[model samples]
Target: MTDDARELADDVQELAEAQRQHWQNTYTTHPGMYGEKPSSPAVHAALVFRAAGAKDVLELGAGHGRDSLYFAREGFTAQATDFRPVGLKQLRRAAQEQGVAARLSTVVHDVRDPLSLPDASVDAAFAHMLLCMALSTKDVQALAAEVRRVLRPGGTLVYTVRHTGDAHYGAGTAHGDDIYEHGGFAVHFFPRHLVDSLADGWTLNQVHAFEEGDLPRRLWGVTQSLPQ
Candidate 1:
Protein backbone atom coordinates (compact mmCIF):
# COMPACT_ATOMS: atom_id res chain seq x y z
CA MET A 1 0.00 0.00 0.00
CA THR A 2 1.09 3.55 -0.69
CA ASP A 3 1.74 6.01 2.14
CA ASP A 4 -1.58 7.69 1.63
CA ALA A 5 -3.42 4.38 1.71
CA ARG A 6 -1.53 3.27 4.79
CA GLU A 7 -2.40 6.53 6.52
CA LEU A 8 -6.06 6.16 5.59
CA ALA A 9 -6.14 2.61 6.95
CA ASP A 10 -4.77 3.84 10.28
CA ASP A 11 -7.56 6.40 10.41
CA VAL A 12 -10.07 3.64 9.74
CA GLN A 13 -8.94 1.66 12.80
CA GLU A 14 -9.44 4.62 15.10
CA LEU A 15 -12.75 5.23 13.39
CA ALA A 16 -13.77 1.62 14.05
CA GLU A 17 -13.00 1.91 17.73
CA ALA A 18 -15.04 5.08 17.82
CA GLN A 19 -17.88 3.47 15.93
CA ARG A 20 -17.97 0.56 18.39
CA GLN A 21 -18.40 2.95 21.27
CA HIS A 22 -21.16 4.78 19.43
CA TRP A 23 -23.11 1.59 18.74
CA GLN A 24 -22.57 0.32 22.26
CA ASN A 25 -24.20 3.50 23.50
CA THR A 26 -26.99 3.35 20.94
CA TYR A 27 -28.01 -0.24 21.66
CA THR A 28 -27.57 0.14 25.40
CA THR A 29 -30.18 2.88 25.47
CA HIS A 30 -32.37 1.35 22.76
CA PRO A 31 -32.19 -2.39 22.20
CA GLY A 32 -34.05 -2.06 18.94
CA MET A 33 -31.84 0.60 17.50
CA TYR A 34 -30.89 -0.31 13.91
CA GLY A 35 -32.86 -3.54 14.28
CA GLU A 36 -35.87 -2.91 12.09
CA LYS A 37 -34.46 -1.68 8.82
CA PRO A 38 -31.65 -3.10 6.73
CA SER A 39 -29.20 -0.86 4.92
CA SER A 40 -28.76 -0.91 1.13
CA PRO A 41 -26.13 -3.62 1.36
CA ALA A 42 -28.34 -5.76 3.57
CA VAL A 43 -31.29 -5.34 1.26
CA HIS A 44 -29.11 -6.14 -1.69
CA ALA A 45 -27.75 -9.22 0.06
CA ALA A 46 -31.27 -10.37 0.85
CA LEU A 47 -32.22 -10.11 -2.80
CA VAL A 48 -29.10 -11.97 -3.81
CA PHE A 49 -29.73 -14.71 -1.25
CA ARG A 50 -33.24 -15.11 -2.54
CA ALA A 51 -32.20 -15.18 -6.20
CA ALA A 52 -29.05 -17.28 -5.91
CA GLY A 53 -30.58 -20.14 -3.93
CA ALA A 54 -28.25 -19.55 -1.00
CA LYS A 55 -28.58 -22.16 1.71
CA ASP A 56 -26.07 -20.83 4.22
CA VAL A 57 -24.98 -17.23 4.74
CA LEU A 58 -22.55 -15.47 7.05
CA GLU A 59 -22.81 -11.83 8.01
CA LEU A 60 -19.45 -10.54 9.28
CA GLY A 61 -20.42 -7.20 10.82
CA ALA A 62 -24.04 -7.86 11.51
CA GLY A 63 -24.86 -4.73 13.51
CA HIS A 64 -28.29 -5.78 14.82
CA GLY A 65 -28.98 -8.98 12.88
CA ARG A 66 -31.34 -7.23 10.50
CA ASP A 67 -29.88 -9.00 7.48
CA SER A 68 -29.46 -12.25 9.36
CA LEU A 69 -33.13 -12.15 10.22
CA TYR A 70 -33.94 -11.44 6.62
CA PHE A 71 -31.88 -14.43 5.49
CA ALA A 72 -33.44 -16.75 8.08
CA ARG A 73 -36.90 -15.60 7.08
CA GLU A 74 -36.04 -16.52 3.51
CA GLY A 75 -35.06 -20.11 4.52
CA PHE A 76 -31.29 -19.71 4.62
CA THR A 77 -29.20 -20.71 7.63
CA ALA A 78 -27.65 -17.42 8.75
CA GLN A 79 -24.83 -16.73 11.17
CA ALA A 80 -24.25 -13.18 12.39
CA THR A 81 -20.90 -12.19 13.87
CA ASP A 82 -19.68 -8.99 15.50
CA PHE A 83 -17.25 -8.08 18.25
CA ARG A 84 -19.77 -6.06 20.25
CA PRO A 85 -21.71 -7.95 22.87
CA VAL A 86 -24.38 -5.31 23.33
CA GLY A 87 -25.07 -5.14 19.62
CA LEU A 88 -25.15 -8.91 19.29
CA LYS A 89 -27.58 -9.19 22.22
CA GLN A 90 -29.88 -6.72 20.51
CA LEU A 91 -29.42 -8.60 17.28
CA ARG A 92 -30.42 -11.86 18.95
CA ARG A 93 -33.54 -10.25 20.38
CA ALA A 94 -34.35 -8.67 17.07
CA ALA A 95 -34.02 -11.99 15.33
CA GLN A 96 -36.40 -13.55 17.85
CA GLU A 97 -38.95 -10.85 17.23
CA GLN A 98 -38.58 -11.42 13.51
CA GLY A 99 -39.34 -15.12 14.08
CA VAL A 100 -35.92 -16.33 12.92
CA ALA A 101 -34.10 -16.49 16.20
CA ALA A 102 -34.01 -20.27 16.22
CA ARG A 103 -32.31 -20.35 12.86
CA LEU A 104 -29.94 -17.44 13.45
CA SER A 105 -26.64 -17.85 15.28
CA THR A 106 -25.15 -14.77 16.92
CA VAL A 107 -21.40 -15.01 17.47
CA VAL A 108 -19.18 -12.50 19.23
CA HIS A 109 -16.29 -12.73 16.86
CA ASP A 110 -14.00 -9.99 15.68
CA VAL A 111 -13.45 -9.92 11.93
CA ARG A 112 -9.79 -9.01 12.25
CA ASP A 113 -9.21 -12.12 14.37
CA PRO A 114 -8.91 -15.62 13.01
CA LEU A 115 -12.28 -16.85 11.75
CA SER A 116 -13.32 -19.93 13.68
CA LEU A 117 -14.77 -21.99 10.91
CA PRO A 118 -13.79 -25.01 8.88
CA ASP A 119 -12.39 -24.59 5.41
CA ALA A 120 -15.08 -23.94 2.76
CA SER A 121 -17.84 -24.06 5.35
CA VAL A 122 -20.33 -21.46 4.17
CA ASP A 123 -22.09 -20.81 0.91
CA ALA A 124 -21.79 -17.04 1.11
CA ALA A 125 -20.28 -14.30 3.28
CA PHE A 126 -21.16 -10.66 3.31
CA ALA A 127 -19.60 -7.73 5.14
CA HIS A 128 -21.26 -4.36 4.89
CA MET A 129 -18.88 -1.47 5.60
CA LEU A 130 -16.43 -3.89 7.24
CA LEU A 131 -13.28 -3.53 5.15
CA CYS A 132 -12.95 0.14 6.02
CA MET A 133 -13.06 -0.54 9.75
CA ALA A 134 -9.51 -1.90 9.98
CA LEU A 135 -6.79 0.33 11.46
CA SER A 136 -4.08 -0.74 9.06
CA THR A 137 -3.31 -2.69 5.90
CA LYS A 138 -2.47 -5.80 7.96
CA ASP A 139 -5.82 -5.86 9.68
CA VAL A 140 -7.61 -5.51 6.40
CA GLN A 141 -5.48 -8.22 4.86
CA ALA A 142 -6.09 -10.59 7.77
CA LEU A 143 -9.83 -9.99 7.55
CA ALA A 144 -9.72 -10.56 3.82
CA ALA A 145 -7.73 -13.75 4.21
CA GLU A 146 -10.20 -15.04 6.77
CA VAL A 147 -13.04 -14.24 4.45
CA ARG A 148 -11.29 -16.22 1.76
CA ARG A 149 -10.30 -19.09 4.02
CA VAL A 150 -13.75 -19.84 5.42
CA LEU A 151 -15.69 -19.51 2.21
CA ARG A 152 -16.34 -22.55 0.07
CA PRO A 153 -14.95 -22.68 -3.41
CA GLY A 154 -17.18 -20.66 -5.71
CA GLY A 155 -18.95 -19.07 -2.76
CA THR A 156 -20.03 -15.44 -3.08
CA LEU A 157 -18.76 -12.41 -1.17
CA VAL A 158 -20.86 -9.28 -1.25
CA TYR A 159 -20.33 -6.02 0.59
CA THR A 160 -20.57 -2.24 0.53
CA VAL A 161 -18.56 0.79 1.72
CA ARG A 162 -18.44 4.57 1.49
CA HIS A 163 -16.72 6.01 -1.58
CA THR A 164 -13.92 8.51 -0.94
CA GLY A 165 -14.45 10.53 -4.10
CA ASP A 166 -17.94 11.39 -2.93
CA ALA A 167 -18.68 14.85 -1.59
CA HIS A 168 -19.36 13.60 1.94
CA TYR A 169 -15.77 14.35 2.95
CA GLY A 170 -16.02 17.78 1.27
CA ALA A 171 -14.81 18.51 -2.24
CA GLY A 172 -11.31 19.81 -3.12
CA THR A 173 -9.93 18.75 0.26
CA ALA A 174 -7.64 15.89 1.20
CA HIS A 175 -9.06 13.26 3.54
CA GLY A 176 -7.24 12.85 6.86
CA ASP A 177 -7.50 11.08 10.23
CA ASP A 178 -8.75 14.16 12.11
CA ILE A 179 -11.78 12.94 14.03
CA TYR A 180 -15.21 14.50 14.00
CA GLU A 181 -17.84 13.30 16.44
CA HIS A 182 -20.79 11.59 14.79
CA GLY A 183 -22.89 9.64 17.26
CA GLY A 184 -20.03 10.24 19.73
CA PHE A 185 -16.89 9.00 17.89
CA ALA A 186 -14.95 9.98 14.81
CA VAL A 187 -15.55 8.27 11.44
CA HIS A 188 -13.30 7.68 8.43
CA PHE A 189 -14.40 7.55 4.82
CA PHE A 190 -12.49 5.18 2.50
CA PRO A 191 -11.46 5.49 -1.10
CA ARG A 192 -12.88 3.04 -3.63
CA HIS A 193 -9.69 1.40 -4.87
CA LEU A 194 -8.43 0.73 -1.35
CA VAL A 195 -11.71 -0.97 -0.49
CA ASP A 196 -11.57 -3.12 -3.62
CA SER A 197 -8.05 -4.33 -2.86
CA LEU A 198 -9.29 -6.03 0.33
CA ALA A 199 -10.40 -9.04 -1.68
CA ASP A 200 -7.10 -10.65 -2.54
CA GLY A 201 -8.04 -13.34 -5.07
CA TRP A 202 -11.77 -13.07 -5.43
CA THR A 203 -13.15 -12.47 -8.89
CA LEU A 204 -15.05 -9.23 -9.00
CA ASN A 205 -18.50 -10.04 -10.32
CA GLN A 206 -20.27 -6.71 -10.13
CA VAL A 207 -19.90 -3.24 -8.69
CA HIS A 208 -23.03 -1.14 -8.23
CA ALA A 209 -23.69 2.32 -6.80
CA PHE A 210 -26.95 3.50 -5.28
CA GLU A 211 -28.43 6.30 -3.23
CA GLU A 212 -31.59 6.90 -1.22
CA GLY A 213 -33.38 9.89 -2.78
CA ASP A 214 -30.21 11.99 -2.93
CA LEU A 215 -29.29 12.54 0.69
CA PRO A 216 -25.63 13.11 -0.13
CA ARG A 217 -24.98 9.43 -0.63
CA ARG A 218 -21.56 7.78 -1.18
CA LEU A 219 -21.93 4.00 -1.03
CA TRP A 220 -20.81 1.32 -3.45
CA GLY A 221 -21.73 -2.38 -3.47
CA VAL A 222 -19.39 -5.10 -4.63
CA THR A 223 -20.17 -8.73 -5.52
CA GLN A 224 -17.36 -11.22 -6.00
CA SER A 225 -16.93 -14.96 -6.41
CA LEU A 226 -14.46 -16.65 -4.07
CA PRO A 227 -11.78 -18.76 -5.66
CA GLN A 228 -12.62 -22.40 -5.90
Candidate 2:
Protein backbone atom coordinates (compact mmCIF):
# COMPACT_ATOMS: atom_id res chain seq x y z
CA MET A 1 0.00 0.00 0.00
CA THR A 2 1.06 3.60 -0.52
CA ASP A 3 2.43 5.57 2.43
CA ASP A 4 -0.57 7.86 2.38
CA ALA A 5 -2.99 4.91 2.53
CA ARG A 6 -1.06 3.30 5.40
CA GLU A 7 -1.07 6.54 7.33
CA LEU A 8 -4.80 6.93 6.86
CA ALA A 9 -5.40 3.39 8.06
CA ASP A 10 -3.30 4.01 11.13
CA ASP A 11 -5.26 7.17 11.92
CA VAL A 12 -8.50 5.26 11.63
CA GLN A 13 -7.24 2.64 14.02
CA GLU A 14 -6.32 5.33 16.51
CA LEU A 15 -9.75 6.80 16.19
CA ALA A 16 -11.35 3.43 16.86
CA GLU A 17 -9.27 3.05 20.00
CA ALA A 18 -10.40 6.44 21.21
CA GLN A 19 -13.97 5.45 20.47
CA ARG A 20 -13.57 2.34 22.62
CA GLN A 21 -12.31 4.40 25.52
CA HIS A 22 -15.22 6.76 25.15
CA TRP A 23 -17.67 3.89 25.49
CA GLN A 24 -15.83 2.60 28.51
CA ASN A 25 -16.17 5.99 30.11
CA THR A 26 -19.83 6.14 29.19
CA TYR A 27 -20.62 3.10 31.30
CA THR A 28 -18.31 4.27 34.04
CA THR A 29 -19.78 7.73 34.22
CA HIS A 30 -23.45 6.96 33.72
CA PRO A 31 -23.82 3.62 35.43
CA GLY A 32 -27.57 3.59 35.01
CA MET A 33 -28.11 5.03 31.58
CA TYR A 34 -30.24 2.03 30.63
CA GLY A 35 -31.60 1.30 34.09
CA GLU A 36 -32.64 -2.19 35.28
CA LYS A 37 -35.65 -2.79 33.15
CA PRO A 38 -35.27 -5.17 30.23
CA SER A 39 -35.72 -3.30 26.98
CA SER A 40 -38.94 -3.90 25.02
CA PRO A 41 -37.04 -5.60 22.23
CA ALA A 42 -35.42 -7.87 24.75
CA VAL A 43 -38.77 -8.77 26.23
CA HIS A 44 -40.15 -9.52 22.77
CA ALA A 45 -37.10 -11.61 21.84
CA ALA A 46 -37.30 -13.57 25.08
CA LEU A 47 -40.90 -14.50 24.34
CA VAL A 48 -39.90 -15.76 20.92
CA PHE A 49 -36.98 -17.72 22.30
CA ARG A 50 -39.14 -19.25 25.00
CA ALA A 51 -41.76 -20.24 22.47
CA ALA A 52 -39.06 -21.89 20.38
CA GLY A 53 -37.95 -23.87 23.47
CA ALA A 54 -34.59 -22.17 23.71
CA LYS A 55 -32.94 -22.84 27.06
CA ASP A 56 -29.26 -21.97 26.87
CA VAL A 57 -28.81 -18.38 25.76
CA LEU A 58 -25.92 -16.00 25.15
CA GLU A 59 -26.42 -12.25 25.45
CA LEU A 60 -23.88 -9.93 23.91
CA GLY A 61 -23.34 -6.35 25.08
CA ALA A 62 -25.43 -7.06 28.15
CA GLY A 63 -25.25 -3.76 29.99
CA HIS A 64 -25.77 -4.15 33.73
CA GLY A 65 -27.52 -7.55 33.30
CA ARG A 66 -31.10 -6.43 32.77
CA ASP A 67 -31.95 -8.81 29.91
CA SER A 68 -29.59 -11.48 31.11
CA LEU A 69 -31.16 -11.56 34.55
CA TYR A 70 -34.58 -11.62 32.97
CA PHE A 71 -33.59 -14.68 30.95
CA ALA A 72 -32.34 -16.44 34.06
CA ARG A 73 -35.50 -15.58 35.95
CA GLU A 74 -37.48 -17.14 33.14
CA GLY A 75 -35.52 -20.38 33.64
CA PHE A 76 -32.96 -20.04 30.83
CA THR A 77 -29.27 -20.33 31.52
CA ALA A 78 -27.75 -17.08 30.31
CA GLN A 79 -24.17 -16.09 29.67
CA ALA A 80 -23.80 -12.34 29.35
CA THR A 81 -20.83 -10.65 27.67
CA ASP A 82 -19.81 -7.01 27.58
CA PHE A 83 -16.66 -5.03 26.80
CA ARG A 84 -17.03 -2.89 29.91
CA PRO A 85 -15.77 -4.34 33.16
CA VAL A 86 -17.62 -1.71 35.18
CA GLY A 87 -20.95 -2.92 33.86
CA LEU A 88 -20.07 -6.57 34.33
CA LYS A 89 -19.17 -5.96 37.93
CA GLN A 90 -22.60 -4.44 38.49
CA LEU A 91 -24.17 -7.39 36.66
CA ARG A 92 -22.48 -9.93 38.92
CA ARG A 93 -23.63 -8.10 42.00
CA ALA A 94 -27.18 -7.82 40.76
CA ALA A 95 -27.29 -11.52 39.91
CA GLN A 96 -26.14 -12.36 43.39
CA GLU A 97 -28.76 -10.11 44.96
CA GLN A 98 -31.45 -11.64 42.78
CA GLY A 99 -30.28 -15.14 43.75
CA VAL A 100 -29.85 -16.04 40.08
CA ALA A 101 -26.08 -16.19 40.22
CA ALA A 102 -26.06 -19.87 39.36
CA ARG A 103 -28.20 -19.34 36.31
CA LEU A 104 -26.38 -16.26 35.00
CA SER A 105 -22.72 -15.55 34.29
CA THR A 106 -20.82 -12.48 33.12
CA VAL A 107 -17.73 -12.18 30.93
CA VAL A 108 -15.74 -9.32 29.48
CA HIS A 109 -15.90 -9.44 25.71
CA ASP A 110 -15.48 -7.02 22.81
CA VAL A 111 -18.08 -7.60 20.11
CA ARG A 112 -15.63 -6.38 17.44
CA ASP A 113 -13.55 -9.50 18.03
CA PRO A 114 -14.36 -13.21 17.73
CA LEU A 115 -16.74 -14.43 20.42
CA SER A 116 -14.95 -16.54 23.02
CA LEU A 117 -17.14 -19.59 23.09
CA PRO A 118 -17.30 -23.06 21.58
CA ASP A 119 -19.09 -23.46 18.26
CA ALA A 120 -22.82 -24.28 18.36
CA SER A 121 -22.93 -24.03 22.12
CA VAL A 122 -25.87 -21.70 22.62
CA ASP A 123 -29.52 -22.16 21.83
CA ALA A 124 -29.97 -18.42 21.24
CA ALA A 125 -27.96 -15.20 21.16
CA PHE A 126 -29.31 -11.72 21.83
CA ALA A 127 -27.89 -8.21 21.61
CA HIS A 128 -30.19 -5.26 22.23
CA MET A 129 -28.17 -2.34 20.84
CA LEU A 130 -24.68 -3.63 20.22
CA LEU A 131 -24.70 -3.31 16.44
CA CYS A 132 -24.72 0.50 16.34
CA MET A 133 -21.85 1.17 18.71
CA ALA A 134 -19.44 2.95 16.40
CA LEU A 135 -18.84 -0.34 14.65
CA SER A 136 -17.94 -0.23 11.02
CA THR A 137 -19.82 -2.41 8.54
CA LYS A 138 -16.96 -4.91 8.69
CA ASP A 139 -17.17 -5.04 12.48
CA VAL A 140 -20.88 -5.81 12.36
CA GLN A 141 -20.25 -8.56 9.81
CA ALA A 142 -17.59 -10.13 12.02
CA LEU A 143 -19.93 -10.00 15.02
CA ALA A 144 -22.74 -11.61 13.00
CA ALA A 145 -20.44 -14.40 11.83
CA GLU A 146 -19.24 -15.06 15.36
CA VAL A 147 -22.81 -15.18 16.69
CA ARG A 148 -23.74 -17.58 13.91
CA ARG A 149 -20.77 -19.79 14.77
CA VAL A 150 -21.62 -20.00 18.47
CA LEU A 151 -25.30 -20.70 17.93
CA ARG A 152 -26.75 -24.19 17.68
CA PRO A 153 -28.68 -25.29 14.63
CA GLY A 154 -32.06 -23.56 14.54
CA GLY A 155 -30.86 -21.19 17.22
CA THR A 156 -32.20 -17.66 17.15
CA LEU A 157 -30.02 -14.55 17.09
CA VAL A 158 -31.88 -11.36 17.97
CA TYR A 159 -30.43 -7.87 17.84
CA THR A 160 -31.37 -4.20 17.51
CA VAL A 161 -29.77 -1.30 15.67
CA ARG A 162 -30.41 2.37 15.15
CA HIS A 163 -32.00 2.58 11.74
CA THR A 164 -31.38 5.32 9.22
CA GLY A 165 -34.75 6.78 10.15
CA ASP A 166 -33.47 7.72 13.60
CA ALA A 167 -33.58 11.43 14.37
CA HIS A 168 -29.86 11.52 15.07
CA TYR A 169 -28.84 9.54 12.02
CA GLY A 170 -27.31 12.37 10.02
CA ALA A 171 -26.99 14.92 12.81
CA GLY A 172 -23.62 13.88 14.24
CA THR A 173 -20.12 14.30 12.89
CA ALA A 174 -19.57 11.74 10.13
CA HIS A 175 -17.10 8.99 10.79
CA GLY A 176 -17.75 6.85 7.64
CA ASP A 177 -20.33 4.44 6.25
CA ASP A 178 -23.27 5.93 8.15
CA ILE A 179 -21.33 6.16 11.41
CA TYR A 180 -21.22 9.42 13.31
CA GLU A 181 -19.89 10.90 16.53
CA HIS A 182 -22.06 12.75 19.04
CA GLY A 183 -21.68 13.74 22.66
CA GLY A 184 -18.37 11.93 23.15
CA PHE A 185 -19.63 8.71 21.55
CA ALA A 186 -19.90 7.12 18.12
CA VAL A 187 -22.84 5.35 16.47
CA HIS A 188 -23.20 3.47 13.20
CA PHE A 189 -26.61 3.95 11.67
CA PHE A 190 -28.00 1.02 9.67
CA PRO A 191 -29.93 1.52 6.50
CA ARG A 192 -32.26 -1.31 5.49
CA HIS A 193 -29.91 -2.38 2.70
CA LEU A 194 -26.97 -2.54 5.06
CA VAL A 195 -29.06 -4.60 7.45
CA ASP A 196 -29.87 -6.99 4.61
CA SER A 197 -26.21 -7.22 3.70
CA LEU A 198 -25.28 -8.17 7.24
CA ALA A 199 -27.97 -10.87 7.31
CA ASP A 200 -26.64 -12.46 4.12
CA GLY A 201 -25.79 -15.93 5.48
CA TRP A 202 -28.69 -16.30 7.89
CA THR A 203 -32.41 -16.66 7.31
CA LEU A 204 -33.98 -13.34 8.16
CA ASN A 205 -37.00 -13.97 10.32
CA GLN A 206 -38.18 -10.50 11.18
CA VAL A 207 -37.30 -6.80 11.03
CA HIS A 208 -39.66 -4.76 13.14
CA ALA A 209 -39.45 -1.03 13.73
CA PHE A 210 -39.77 0.64 17.11
CA GLU A 211 -39.04 3.98 18.72
CA GLU A 212 -37.49 4.76 22.10
CA GLY A 213 -36.59 7.75 24.25
CA ASP A 214 -38.07 11.27 24.21
CA LEU A 215 -36.20 12.11 20.95
CA PRO A 216 -37.76 8.88 19.76
CA ARG A 217 -34.75 6.90 18.71
CA ARG A 218 -35.87 4.85 15.75
CA LEU A 219 -34.57 1.28 15.74
CA TRP A 220 -34.97 -2.01 13.94
CA GLY A 221 -35.43 -5.17 15.91
CA VAL A 222 -34.11 -8.01 13.79
CA THR A 223 -34.14 -11.75 14.28
CA GLN A 224 -32.26 -14.33 12.23
CA SER A 225 -31.44 -17.97 12.52
CA LEU A 226 -28.92 -20.43 11.10
CA PRO A 227 -30.38 -22.99 8.73
CA GLN A 228 -31.02 -26.10 10.75
Evaluated with lDDT, which candidate comes out highest? 2
Give the runs in model 2 whose Cα sits over 4 Å from its true position: 1-12
Q: So what's the TM-score on candidate 1?
A: 0.81
Candidate 2 residue 177 Cα shift, in angstroms, is: 1.3
| Candidate 2: Cα lDDT at 220 | 95
For residues 112-167, what per-residue lDDT tens digits would candidate 2 score against the true structure?
77988999999999998788877777778888888888999899999999988888
Instruction: Point to the candidate with the largest TM-score.
Output: 2
What are the models' TM-scores? 0.81, 0.93
